[model samples]
Target: MNLLFVASECAPFVKTGGLADVIGAVSKSLATTGVNVRVLIPAYPAVAALVATGKTVMTFDDLFGGRARIVAAQAEGLDMLLLDAPHLYDRAGNIYLGPDGKDWHDNDLRFAALSFAAAQIGLNGLGGWVPDVINAHDWQAGLVPAYLRQDGRPAPPVVMTIHNISFQGVFDGTRLSALGLNADQFTQQGVEYYGKISFLKAGIALSQKITTVSPSYAAELLTPDFGMGLDGLLRERQLDLHGILNGIDLDVWDPETDASIVATYSATKLAGKTKNRAELEARFGLTKSDGPLFCVISRLTSQKGLDMLLDCLPDLLAEGGRLALLGTGEPYLERAFIDASNRYSGTVGTIIGYDEGLSHLMQAGSDAILIPSRFEPCGLTQLYGLRYGTLPVVARTGGLADTVIDANEAALLADCATGIQFAPINGLMFGHAISRTCALFAKPKIWTAMMRRAMRHPVGWDLSAAAYLDVYKSALAP
Candidate 1:
């Protein structure tokens, strides 16, 4: 079957988070199963450099106040349809934000245009190759189904996948006409949310199927806690929703073959991992320790529960554990972590920015990875840790709960314990989780066994792609 993916970002070319990785990996994995996948992403500088040289399949005289065209290209082993609109997509540094550190004023029009283009492609096949199914990812591509519905054409079935429900593309309801939204469709039953128009809600309300990054998150979206104000609509469309777990690109994340890490290692041969750990300590200016070395590779946001981690840091250091953190987000969290690094000195080392290579080495080197998220929509770092034999210490929520088998006695006895999981997201529990991890690390035999088990865990996309195919088949059903 031929499939088209409409997403804001894709791996290697442009990425702000796991959504891009998912798009790139899913396309490749689905292709292995005989699915012809084409991803439609904005022509950011990196993508434009490669895709601008490809065939121009479709052009627009005027789309959302600018001339635009779609360039079909193949790069990095993936087929992509680049929306080459410089006026909308061309900028330096961050793609979504301007130099002023605020969202670009034209974001609503920008992504709406992307969705509008997708609707066009769905209605009129590109280059005589119509997509059998269109998978719209995140709120950026949320209006694809709505645009198709507005066109009133027999379009390919659209599957709206919510990578994170918190980022719904909501704007003024008064700008419905500016967005080219049908005035008649502005009721509560339509794209209307409170007094505004939410692109994510429009997609959820109009699409044939809905999916989240993980099954556990799929269930979480039904409750008020995780719904982010759209639980009512999600409850209404519960039958159409699916919770398909996400998988990583195993080839890219493999510890043995990854060129980004300082040393190569695997489940069977873990000697190199020791070398990597030493190298990681040196990079972060951290002191070597006999205790567990924990790494955090994530956005430093409250939603990630980094503050709680800060509270547990003193205890972690008191227990002889070491930390190496690499990420940037939220001004306060960044300051706090920096402060901790200074106060804790050799025990805590923090990098205030993101480095892809450093992240890979951290996973390869660290004895464990910390992901105590208050709420997670299927984190990919934990999966990468699992693949690298770095046991994950995570919160018991969303995909973290679904993926990691806690190192409880039952799981340990079965020799299938992969990582540590803590519940009741609070400082006390988080501290206990850290202490528990330290205790587990003290047991060398059990710790090594768990690492091997984690490395053996299936974090690849084979099963996930097959599950996506099944969803597509179901959507195409008469």
Candidate 2:
């Protein structure tokens, strides 16, 4: 199987969030299954530095009216093709955002060039390397399917995976001609979304198959709450849609072998976890206690339900629980957490930025990881928690709902529970869940069993990669 993955970002190269992690891990996992997977991403500064030895494979004269070329290189054991268009991708603080913390004005043109190049490769092949399936990820590469369709040629099957529907890449319809898209495409049945061109909508409209990060997210996107104004169109393609739960890279996330954490431990031998806990307490300058230590490693944004967690902080401290957070986002949220750490000194510790090493330590040391997301497409932190035997207390939404089995009476009795899940994500419910987790923490026998069960749960990409292969095969079917 020849598969081409087109995306804006990829991990260990250039990453903003889970989308990059998914593309990086899934592409590698698929290659292990003997599928020839090749990835295409923009040559951002970080990516260009890594692929400095990469050679130019093909050059195009009229790609978005600029001299664009494809540079083939190998990174993280995967074949990568970098779209080397310096004019479009060179200046970057963030991939999509400028130095002023706003989106670059020419983002539409930048990504349109990326999608256009990907379409050319999908349709005509690069150096006789035609892909059997062209997989476009997120709004960044969403126009690939549309560009291929507009080529009016028999092209490889296209599949678009919506990592997050919240960002639809809606642009002014006036820029359609500049993007090389037909004026007629700016219609209700086409890419037009309320008189705007929605890049994600174009993918949904033109791709042979559509998939989201999780099964629950797939169902959620069919409703107005999660669809971001594309529910009706998504409903029309119900049968063609799929919900494949993403898998974590076990080798990188495993607790037993993680060098980032203070101590290495497994589900069987958990003594190292205690040492890790003490180290975490010392590092964060928190008072060491036997109380349950809860960790939060996520973006401090409203969508992540950080506000609800903030609201429930007093309740959590009242229960004699300790909270530790490590992430960076939303200025107000960062200040709120920092203030909380100061006000509730020793009980709450906040690191207002991301540290990869600290994240691993937080998981290994904490009793439970909290993910009170308002809506999660597919959460990687909870999956990492499951692997580390750090029980996740997540809201009942998206992949959190699918991956976690709530430790209710039925689940505990059946011995199949992995973590605690609460619905109607709010301060009261999240606090109640934290209280429940603390109660469970007091029962060492039951809590140990749950931890073992969580560690035993499947977190690797084997099954998800196989499911993706099936999707690719289905896309190629006559």
| Strongest candidate by lDDT | 1
- By TM-score, who's the top model here? 1
- What lDDT tens digits, residue by residue, belong to model 1 across residues 5-98? 9999999789998999999999999999999999999898877677757999999988888899999989889999999888899889888999
What are the per-residue Cα lDDT tens digits for candidate 2 across 239-330? 99999999998888988999988789988898889988998898787898777999999988999999998889888888879999999989
Question: Model 2: clashing residue pairs?
Answer: none
State the TM-score for model 1. 0.99
Candidate 2 residue runs with Cα over 4 Å from true position: none
What are the TM-scores, per candidate, against the unseen true structure? 0.99, 0.98
Taken over the whole model, the C-alpha lDDT of each candidate is 0.92, 0.90
Q: How well does model 2 score by local distance difference test?
A: 0.90
